[model samples]
Target: MERGRDTILLEGLRILDLTYGPSGGYAGRLFAESGAHVTKVVTGDQEISTFKDSRKRMIRTTDNQLPETIAEQLAVGHWDIVLWDSHMALHLESQLASLLEKISGSCLSVRIHFPSTVDVKEEHALQEWGGWTSLTGDPHRSPLYIGGFPATSLVGAHTAAATMFAWLEQKKGFVQVDALTVVVSALEGVYTNYLETGEVRERVGNRHHTLTPMSIFPCQNGFSFIGAPVDEQWELLERWMGRAPNPNWASVDERQQSYPALEHCIADWTQGMEREELFHTGQAFRLPFGDVQTLEDVKRCPHLNMRHFWKGQHPSDGIQLPWIIYRHSSCKLENRSHSLKRLRILDLTSMWSGPYCTRLFADHGAEVIKVEAPHRPDGIRGNSGESPAPFFNELNRNKCGITLDLRQEEERAKFLKLVATSDILIDNFSPRVMENFGLTREVLWAQQPGLIIMSLSAFGQTGPYRDYVGYGPTLESMSGLASLTGYRDGIPWLPGFSISDIGAGIHGTFALLAALYFQRRFGNGLAVDLSQYEAAIQLIGDYIIEETFSPTPLQPVGCTSIAELAIQDQRPLEVKTSDGKRSISTPWIIDNPENQTYEPAPTLGQHNPLLEDYMAKREWHHQL
Candidate 1:
């Protein structure tokens, strides 16, 4: 476990560990191993627990009362980075402010939280942000929550990287992050998909919108994912089966109509072989064929093991954490030793921006410690009435978690002690939120001269809409993504997909890396103000530009022009009789084409528990 800490990534940094719950914890876990000194500060009662034999210990603090004195003490010391959940600032703004005034300078502070719809008053903070909930969902229907803690957790990583940038620049000032910005970053690819084709992707029930032979196929026991993106792979598949393309399934459209027959044919051939054989066969043909592995399968994949994607470590007692890697690099020997190497992070800015940003850091190669309040947990945790579900786990992979009642005078002291040695800090609360929490940039700079800080929110901290509330769906609607999808013949619809939130994470990683590069070169600090809603809007840049330049502006899918095109081009040309039933007939002829289809979305909470147990056992026993 100790050996892993010496990883060539973040070798010479100190991280003040103070992230409560799974989201922040996941971030801290990543930074800790890359040679960062992450001192997890917890209330004394919260003993460190390690489900496996990992070395990192969860420091349990004796003080659970509000107003963290530990945080103040840590801030007064020599630290580089600071991480915290949003509630820490909201609940302990006063106490933290006083401490911040007293601290030296140079330390970065990070805070993460969920957006709130309700207004916040002293001792009465309400959430329900605008972007996340409104932007990505159908306007007519009630907004539905997308399940994925990564959306929020990666915000933590953003906070971390942005803080590091400021530290390297020796900058001093409060910073804020926008959740919508993070969403936009992650959705760039999807947005590009639309721009390249002038087609907004609809909820096609997991079917590919344009690509053929790229869908989930049913197997004997479960499902397997397959992708034959090119014609060569398709030809290889046919050769493997020793059969030519059927006449009815020649073209893409024809294959859609004759889907049943194609499905049967493919299943007959695949069902006869073993799962390994099928996987190997696909690999042999240079096709992408992956099993729908359970969490357990993820733990045991040989490729992952060879690549060292998951770290086997016993942090304390009962928890077995398999550190997952989302970022990687092949070269790190001469370029900066550590100080965050092989660690790529994307911090999607939002109310809970810091958490989402840092989660990715933890996954790759960075010790990200998130600071949060025990009295007030992250809003997203309580939103669905399930605090730490798979949603949290998925986002917080490979990080450490802890609590800091920043309001307490004593806990503030502990926070300083931890921060004296960190790499970055991020926050998504409003501009005043940090001031209220006693985390002004001056205070952090006094503590650590080279600390980077990133502030994320709905709008930037300095913007007019900085205080807006935003969640996934709301952000979709606000970012104009929701207005782009739907049946071409009907009204524009909100995509059920949470592309905004996910895209932000990817974008955050890119931004964080750029900031990190500046830090390493200058040895100074910086403060980055990230806007989540603006970030979401960035994903649709081409659309915005085209609208400004084109004579006829593009509207949503169901606009008049699109509706006309659909009627003329896509209406079923004729009806057909199959057996005794009448069915729609495809216009084009098909000789033998792949029947690319997808199964239903996996049921919520359908992860395999037995496999989880086995993986847990492996984590407990040894480094496999």
Candidate 2:
């Protein structure tokens, strides 16, 4: 047997696990394979069916009545990690306090539960803590629930990572966290963009502001992506287009202005080839080329298997699954001699939130393939031009893409074939859409029972609004983001960007990774129902907590023009909560006076022959 190098990190720590279901089970599994020992503690008939070895397991008394005693006993022992996932029962707070008090040394304590503490003062602080839902949804619509079961579960995962970091650094003290602030912290790059300008970013579909030649294009077969970062690639693109490098269109800016000419050139070249051929040829040219793969195309990516990206295996259905799992170069997977190694993910989810979550996996080392349909492509795709626009490409990079007409029977079958092979399947489409396409949980499980399905929708599958047709704007309105946003005096303003959807996407990715981690340990499957509205609510949970605990509601600031002007010449406005906690937000306004309304995208398909068949055969033979 090819024993893949044991890469799982955190190898020796032991977790006194009290979590149940996929969420907590996942967290425990992650700790376990990362070189930790996760001994699940359960009472009554509820065993760790998620894993099969429960027969040789540690069991507490059947008395759910003595969980406090169980926790206290576990705390006193030499356990390095403590993971708890129980509902907020009436006496849960007292029980937890007793358990914390009994711990002899400073080990990590991970608590995953809803609010029910006696002390109300901490609630306001928690709400204002961060990942504040205020940033979610569209300006017009009520803030929607985040897609997938994001908010709380993501908070739990964040807590785990933070606690792990604290434990690793040997730091002790109360470390309060929530989903909102964690999301913001993950936006280091996005925040840098904001800091450079003086304006907050609004949604702009999938179009990127900084890069050119990064957009999805419709091909004879379907859709494909081309991302060219510089000029030489643009020239090489011209070679592909059967045209000599245009001297006039030498610069990125020049090529952007002559977008029509560039598009015409590319259109002629791409119009001649098959989708797969276009993708391979583009990749050979070293251009960031990806197919807007549908669920089907994603399933068949050989790169994923070669790279060992999908791990959670389902025997009955025999499908490889995707998870929110990634690895950094520093955390060598081959060095650790582990089952599943430490992986870093940076999810940037929105509409169905799949892309955002996959971004996390992609950023690390997971071979994430983002699926988009051309006809009813991601809503974010069509928000710009008649063509499938650059918006989709920006949100989806470092990953492969392919288009599928899920509406068609052949396409639907192709999609199923792909699902049978994917490690993770994240979709924010409504439950009805999946059902219409024959992609229900039962259907998916039947295909590959161990598949980790990260379903992102406007509302949950079982909720009253389960069938509601809501987008970022509608979800924003529903989630109360609209009411919370805008000027202090005028009507509440919706943000130009779909923060809620995007936020939900990021959080959903976190949740999916957690699930993947768990499924790996148990050899089972998990279905994460992520509601975008709920995810939004989770992001702003601290704010909601503030409203519940504080004397006044969170004050919404509409126009920051006054604040902007005040900081125009001075330092940027930094906000301090009433309790003296400080935070900052920046906008994306350009400082250069010569800024134009639209900066053009760089042309990658400049040279006609380089991207054409004549060059195609040469490139083909060269690879062989």
Best by lDDT: 2
Backbone clashes, each candidate: 219, 101
The segments of candidate 2 whose C-alpha lies over 4 angstroms from its true place after superposition are 1-8, 18-26, 40-78, 84-91, 104-106, 111-160, 171-175, 192-197, 243-250, 253-272, 308-624
lDDT (10s digit) by residue, model 1, range 91-122: 46556545544552666665544333212110
Error of 2 at 513 (Å): 18
Displacement of residue 520 (Cα, Å) in model 2 is 25
lDDT of 2 by residue, 349-430 (tens): 3333566556434433344444455554454443442333333333443444445566788757655655654556777666
For residue 353, what is the lDDT in candidate 1? 40
TM-score of 1: 0.46
Q: What TM-score against the true fold does each predicted structure earn?
A: 0.46, 0.44
Minimal lDDT window, size 10, model 1: 119-128
